[model samples]
Target: MRSLEIHGVDDLRVVERAQPEPGPGEVQIAVEWGGICGSDLAYWRHGVSGTATMRHPFVLGHEVSGRVSALGPGVDGFAVGLPVTVHPARTSGPLPERLAGRDNLHPDLTYLGSAARDPHTDGGFAERITVRAEQVVPLPDGLDTRRAVLAEPLGVAIHAVHRAGDVTGAHVLVSGCGPVGLLTILAVRAAGAARVSAVDLSPLARERALALGADVALDAAEQLGQDVTVAFEASGAPASLEAILRVVARAAVVVQAGNLPPAPVSVALGPIVSKEIDYRGTYRFVSEIEEAVELLARSELAEGVISHELDLADAGAAFTTAATDPHSSKVVLRLE
Candidate 1:
C-alpha cells in the first residue's frame, strides 16, 4: 500500500508501506476519493500549534470515501464491495461535550488525519485504510463514490446551519465561498432562509454560491446594506468577522466555522455585547453524518462541486492547489 506523510511544513512524501489489517469490529477499505480540507493545508504548512504536537511525519487527510475490500472479526451486517464514507470523529472515550450528545466537541478527540491520529497514513488518501466499523457509513445504491466523499464536509455544513438557529424567513449572510461556505449556502437555502448573501474574494466561488442557490454573492470587501438576521463566518479572515459584526442585526446569531490560525484574531466585541448577539463556534457534527448523506442523496450540490481530481501520488500538488487556487472549489485525491 502507498500513503502520503507530512514530515514538516510544505513537506509531503508519498511512500510505499505494508497494508494494514483490520482489528476486531473494523473494516479495511480501498479508498476511492479523499477531499482536501482547509485544516489539512494548515497542518501541512505550519505543522500543528507552533510545532509541538505535529512533530515530523504525520499523515493528513480526513474527508474520505471508499469501498469495503474486507471486514474484520465481529463486524457484521456490512459486507465487501459496499461503498462507504468514513466518519472522522472517534467518540469512544469520555468527554463532557460528547456525553451530552455533542460528540463534535469531544476535547481529546482526534480525526482520521492529524498530528494526533495520522489518518493520511490511516486516511482514504492512501490505497487502503482500516477503520472501526462504527466509522463507516454505507452509501446508498444511487450515490456515486465521488459524491459520497462529500458526506464528511456536508455534515460540517449541516452542523453550521444548526448553530445559526432559525434561518427561515431571515436574511442570511455567509462570509466565505469555499467548499464549506458554498455547502452552508445550500443548507441555508434548504432551511428556507428568505434570502442568502455569499461573500468571497474569488469570483468563481461567488458564482458557484449563486449557482448553488444564494440570492446574492458579494465580494468580502463589500458590506450588505441591510442587516442579516444570521451569519456564518466561513471566511476565517478577521475582516469577515468584523463585517459580520457590523452587518448582522441585533440579537442575530453568528456561527464561526472556519479555522483561523497562527494566532487568535482580534474582533470587535462591542456589537456582540451591546446587541446581545450570539457568537458561537461549530465543529464537525457526529450526529449529522446520516443526515448529510441523505441530503446529498437528495440534493444536487455534490454533482458539479468537485473541480479537480488528482492521483494519490500527486497529492502534494493537490494540497498546493487547494491552498493557492481560489478557483478550485473542491479537490479530491483518488487513492486507487
Candidate 2:
C-alpha cells in the first residue's frame, strides 16, 4: 500500500508501506477519498498547526471516507464493502470530562493525522489503514463515498451551531465563506435560523455561499449594517472576530468556531460586558458526525463545495492547489 506522509516543512511524499491489519475491535478501511484540511496545509507549509510542531513524519489526512475491507475480532453490526466515514478522534483515561460524556474535552484527546502529540498518530491518506471500529460511522443508504468524505467537516459545523445555542428564527452571521464557514451556513439553516448572511474576501467563496442558501453574501470590508442575534466566527482572523463583535445585537451569542493562533489577540471588552453577550468556544464535535452525514445524504450539501479532485499519486500537487487556490473549496484526493 501507499501513504502520503509529511516529512518536514514543504516536504511531502508518496511512499510504499505495508498494508495494515485490524486489531481487536478495529476495522481495516480501503480509503477512497480524503479531503485536505486547513491544518493539513499548515503542517505542509510551516510544519506546524497552532502550537503543535511536527515531531516526525506522519500521515496527513483526517476528513476521509472509504469501504470496509476487513473487520477485527469481536466487531459486528458492520461488514465488508460497507461505506463509512471516520470520526477521527480518540481519547484515553477516564477523566471527569470523559465520564461526563464530553470526551472531546478530554485532556489526552488524539485527533487522527494531527501533530499535536509526540509520535503523531497515522491518518487515513493511504490505500489501506486500520482504525478502532468505534471511530467508523457507517454511511446511510444512497450516500456516496464522495459526499460522505465531507462528514468530518460538517461535524465541525454542526458542533459550532450547537455552540451558538438555539438559533431558531434568529438572524445569523457567518464571518467566513471557506468550506467550514459555508457549511456552517448550511448547518445553521438546518438548525432553523431565520436568515443567514456570509462574509468573505474571496468572491468565489461568497458566490458559493449565496448559492448554498446564504440570504446575502458580502465582502469582508463591507459593514453588515444590521444587528444579528447570533454570529459564528469561522475565518480564524482576529479582525473578523472583531467585526462580528461590533455588529451583533445586545445579548447575542458569538461562537468562535475557527482555529485561532496561539498568540494573544486584542478585543474590546465593552460590548461583552455591556450587552452581557454569551461568547463561547467550540471544539471538535461528539456525536455530530452522524448528523452531518444524514444532512449531506438528504441535500445537495456537497455541491459547489468540492472544487478539485486528484489521484492519490498527485498528493503534493493537491496540497499546493488547496493552499494557493482561494477560489477552491474542498480539495479531495482519490485513493481508490
Error of 1 at 100 (Å): 0.7
Compared with the true structure, what per-residue lDDT tens digits does model 2 show for residues 77-157? Answer: 898999999999998877684358667788888998998889898888999989999999999988999988899999999
Candidate lDDT values, in order: 0.82, 0.90
Model 2 TM-score (2 dp)? 0.97
Candidate 2: stretches off by over 4 Å? 97-99
TM-score, one value per model: 0.93, 0.97
The backbone clash count of each candidate, in order, is 4, 0
Specify the poorest-scoring 10-residue window by lDDT in model 2. 218-227
